[model samples]
Target: MRLEAVGRRYRARGPWVLRGIDLDVPEGALLRVEGGNGSGKSTLLRLLAGIDVPTTGRITGRPRTAYVPERFAATLPFDAAGYLVHMGRVHGLCGRQAAARTEEWLERFGITGFAGTALDRLSKGTAQKVAVAQALLAEPELLVLDEAWAGLDTAARALLDEAVTERVAAGGTAVYVDHDPRRLAEAVPRRHRVAAGRLTDGPGGADEMARVVIEAEGTGEPPAALPPHSWTAGPAAGAPGLLRIRVPADRADAALRALLDADPPWHIRAVRSTGGTSPSGAVR
Candidate 1:
């Protein structure tokens, strides 16, 4: 699957959200899209999924690509199992085959009880699990996810992580968006960031280690108030609302914990680290 020079603009918007984005995704590959909010990562995924057309550029790939967005689309009024079966049928599975596969995915995602319950009645997280199941039921050649990990707890995250790994091992390609660099690194994924209408590997490609860069932003916040060297105050290009902190290759984990414990208003929107050994195995 490939998207070359892809771009999108909403209703004559002044700036392009996705500009000249290009990517080549091969079978069995998992690519993580990392970027700050409004950076157009989700838009790029949507375009690739064929949910929306690109204003410029071209995408070439098999039609079996599937996408799971941040907000799971509401299922028609039906029990969870019914919905799964419906989705499977849409993917071309016959009755018995669809039922068997739905059962397997429901258990795999740990949402079995939801089988008899209405999808709308389930919690947000539970609903997402079904959406994930729907996406995987077809076992598409290419899977695209947008912020799929945001609301999930540790266990759920781990489950999906394993599933994604297994899928790739079975010759499937995936495009996923999430905030966890450590998870992405664990998968040995190819990482890219969408910024200023372009996508780049940004300091690391497929072989580099994962790095997390946290920045403090907001008015009247002291950059020096945080740990020295590990956190610094600076302007991030095209991001005036950000105070950048470039985590050293050796200090990422501890630095991240320190920042989390500190509970600063600033949050890590994207990771800019390549891989290296970290101090005390913290975040290197």
Candidate 2:
């Protein structure tokens, strides 16, 4: 899917929430959208999900899409299971298939007990699970999550993570926004920041390329041929043998694969963004 100079606003003369945006949402891409509050991140997502249209410019080649909005309306007059089954059907699943998927998701989210319970009667977290399930049941080609992890328990949050990984691995596209910077920080390759009604590539300014920090512990030497433009820090105090490796965000997966595929794999401790740090001693 592609957006060409897309712009959006509530009214014709109202200030633009977003403008001068051009983006290419490739198949199988995992993109992250970031911004401050009232910065049009949600607006851009709604546009991608077809929940809202651009007031100016054009969007073309959108695929089959599903979206979990920031605020899910749990007041729908249907039981949790019934609602999911209906959503599945709307996404082109047959009756039996829809029912089966509904059961599977409810079980996965540990909400099977509430399958027959009315949506309006469920707790906030439970309702959020139902909202997430409705989107994942049909495996839409494009999935948009707007803070869908909020209100979910740790187990359910992990389940959503696995589901998204599966979706992208199966050649689908997923876009999301979350307050937690560490949420899927290791997997997402493309990140765009929305600010002042405009979109900028990467997590920050053009000169400040995003970087991934990998903390690992290894007995022997680090893996051969670590990704280029990467650096390693000597072990820190109180943590002997702890290797802090930093690489450009785009090469993070490659760096990880090399480490994991070594003769004796390195034990990864943590992975996070550098924010904006440029240490010396680049790996050859």
Candidate 3:
């Protein structure tokens, strides 16, 4: 899907929550949205999912889409399986196929035991599993997840991760918003941020570009556990045991994790992100 100069607001003349959002979300692209709270990140996701329309500018090329919000209303009247089956039909699935797919996803998310349980009785984690499962039932061409991992357990979170990987591998477009910068850090997804009423591309530079400055104090060189290419560091000029490392933002989390996990853990003084700036959230 494509958005050109898009903008939105609640009242006809209320403050615009998002503006000038020009983005091209093609098939097979996994994009991550970031920013502080009330930054209009959720508004952008809603627009992309067709839950709301842009009051200004235009959006086009939307495809068969599915969305899982941060919170799912688990107080519905139907049981887990029945609700999924109903949603499946809404997504153009026939009864038998929908039922089969519901079973498949329920079991995949490790929520099959609760499949027959009423939605209102399921636990938060189980309800989250159901939310994710419902969105995947149709194998949608576009999947939007807005903090869908908030209440999931580790295993179920991993299942959702795998589900997203599979969806993108099948040429679908997935856009998500999450508070954790490292939610899918390993994927090295296209990054975008919502801030100050504008949507802008996240940090980016050449592979050799250093986006994170890691200052630490360690006894020796980096352990063999860390890949050589992940970072480059040297002892602080005159300060013994002090090391300064520069790493790419995409690998910063893993790099930091590895550093802290070493035998004699390195004491991290500070880790600061260093990169380009987005002016007024224009897509560049």
TM-score of each: 0.70, 0.74, 0.72
The best-first sequence of candidates by lDDT reads 2, 3, 1
Best by TM-score: 2
Model 2 Cα lDDT, one tens digit per residue, 112-154: 9999999999999999999999999998999999999999999
Task: Compose the digit string of candidate 1's lDDT tens values, residues 95-181.
Answer: 898899999988887889779999889888888888888888887778888878767768888877766765654446778888777
Which parts of model 1 are misplaced by more than 4 Å? 206-284
Judging by lDDT, tell me the better candidate of 2 and 3.
2
Question: What RMSD, rounded to one decimal, does every model reach?
Answer: 14.7, 9.5, 12.5
Which residue pairs in candidate 2 have backbone atoms (N, alpha carbon, C) closer than 3 angstroms, thus clashing? none
Ranking 2 against 3 by TM-score, winner: 2
The candidate scoring highest on lDDT is: 2
- Runs of candidate 3 exceeding 4 Å displacement: 204-284
TM-score for candidate 1: 0.70
Which 10-residue window in model 1 sums to the lowest lDDT? 229-238
Better of 1 and 3 by lDDT: 3
TM-score, prediction 2: 0.74
**How many clashing residue pairs appear in each of the predictions shown?**
5, 0, 0
